[model samples]
Target: MSPTIFYGQTGKFTFRMLATVLGGQSICILLGALVARAIAATDQGSGSSTAYLVVGVGLGALCIVAAGLMRRPWGVTLGWVVQALTLLSALVVPMMFVVGLFFLALWVTCLVKGAKVDAEMARREAAAGGSEAGADDDGTADRVDG
Candidate 1:
């Protein structure tokens, strides 16, 4: 519930997000290539599908940027946007089910990990302050007794 639990330590979370984005992008690229190949084989004119694949890759790249900017509002927003788009793709193309599932899982992982990372950072900060306060009080206590 605390904000710190969502915005504190972000190193691991950021890394995971980056990995997820990269992985997602790769999947998109691969799928797009396959679609293009299929279209070519059937002479189905897959230009549009190829375009979609390019868009997916672009979105993935944006997500990567977002992961890096996790500390910024833009990063989170862009990441969510990419996630939404990935999910939406499923509605139009059932073939994208596998990619959709993977992206969804990755998104959830980022959310949970992001929160945990922040909580950990906050805890560390608090502990550091507590130690500093304890040390400061130690000298005062001895001085008062003397």
Candidate 2:
């Protein structure tokens, strides 16, 4: 059986970019749980601390897992989903609207810019080595050994 390759080796600018944003989001989600609990203290209608922690940890886990899944094709899709959920989090924490928007913009910018950088790096590598990496069906790069 052929071994599955990992695309991360060929291009990691986007990976690092997304990981930073997602890691920060995960931490924020966890912290938001405390905020939610505090907010609920003053407002009975805001929900319970247990529920907040559960939801917060769940969302935070999603972010962390999404970061780990960056080598897969669907990882980017999952990242987008995380972004949407983060934005939707404003429903629970009003301040999250601004935070979510900021992270969303950062995510988009990072993705776009990171891809360009990776491509440029790949071009440079190919020009220097006179060989190009071929992508596998699973979205990983097949490094050609000269």
Candidate 3:
């Protein structure tokens, strides 16, 4: 297969991994928060932890939506929402567990994969000596321009 095809596949794989990891995290965090509330029920009003539940649900929704959308606009929006909720609900550690620091690491991997794929495509395109890649006036490859 072509380098573009291979790199593109790698990029796609990374994207999928990011989505799965983030989605899984959101669910786990929501579950953890529920467990915490159950344990705390003996001490105070269960209703008192409403903020935690709400944030967990919201963040979990965001992560789910983000995972569904991947790198699309909705995905970015949902990711921002998740990040905002994470910041606002800093008091809840379990929420982070569900939201996933591991997914953050996966996201970095996704970025690297995307960048590598892009670079490979650009290189291949340039080596093919296409005008789109800043070929010389005669269509020969040029070291610079694009």
Candidate with best lDDT: 2
Please give, for residues 1-146, the per-residue lDDT of candidate 2 as tens digits: 11122233314878788878999989888888678767777877655767877887899999999889876777777888888998898887888878788888888777778778988998887785543346565646777799
RMSD of each: 6.0, 10.0, 10.7
Candidate 3 lDDT, 35-124, residue by residue in tens: 555655655655656666665676677778777776563554455456555545545554554345555555556556755766687788
* lDDT (10s digit) by residue, model 1, range 1-146: 53222233345555466456645655574565456445545555444665655665665566566656666645555656666766666554555667766776766676677667756988897987776754554534223554
**Over 4 Å off, model 3:** 1-14, 94-100, 118-146
Cα error, residue 126 of model 2, in Å, equals 1.2
Q: Rank the candidates by lDDT, best first.
A: 2, 3, 1
Local error of candidate 2 at residue 33 (angstroms):
1.8
